[model samples]
Target: MKFTGSIMITCVKATELIEKRQIQSLTLGERFKLRLHNSMCVACRAYQRQSKTIEKAISRWMHITNNTTHHLSQEKKDKIIEELKKL
Candidate 1:
């Protein structure tokens, strides 16, 4: 879907497009619209930058959490079991 230079999108639509682009590929029209909007709108550009930062942080957190391992020591496990039995 090619858009002529005449079409204009609102900031809300542009931000939604930014988010959608994160999850999936966007059509050329959508990409063009977003870039055009971002170039003209300061708030939308800031929002897009913030969104990208948040996505990067979340991805880093997920990677760290997935790779790390946690374990309870035998003493702690035994104590917890004994306490449960008393209850």
Candidate 2:
């Protein structure tokens, strides 16, 4: 199937396009083809959903880590390291 300036993309191509969309903007033709594939393909749709869910989760985790100032005490860190060595 044609992907860039053409029509009809396969499931694999569609999923690749989905991932590319997350990192960069897709061309009009590429977006059209991906949407067409998603309309008819259940697995691709599910994959897209799962990808978005993971992206959101990672974004949230990063945001929380960046904004929070929770630091472990030196004693806590040493204790944890000692416990790990015991294993």
Candidate 3:
């Protein structure tokens, strides 16, 4: 379905979109709308960037932890915890 230009997605829905890239491959029309909406909506843009950062961090953590059954190195674990603390 085509998005009507009149309505912007809600914050929760925009977050979902950020996490899933649900509309990353937007049609040209949708892309234009998103750009306009994001430019005007600081909250939505912040939510999107924060959520995307979380998604990437989770992926990286998974990759690091999945490499072996052995416990994660203490240094690595401490670094991760430190970074999370900053968040």
Better of 1 and 3 by lDDT: 1
Over 4 Å off, model 2? 1-6, 60-87
Which candidate's lDDT is highest?
2
Q: Write the per-residue lDDT of candidate 2 for residues 1-87, one digit (tens) a residue.
A: 355455778888999999999899998788888888899999999999999999999988877746557788999999999999999
Model 3, span 1-87: residue lDDT tens = 466655576666555555556445656655665667787889989887777788789888877746557887999999999999999
| TM-score per model over all chains | 0.60, 0.58, 0.51
Rank by TM-score (best first)? 1, 2, 3
Q: In model 3, what lDDT does residue 69 have?
A: 72
In order, candidate lDDTs are 0.87, 0.89, 0.70
The lDDT of model 2 is 0.89
- State how far residue 43 of model 1 sits from its true place (Å): 0.8
Q: State the lDDT at 22 in candidate 3.
A: 48
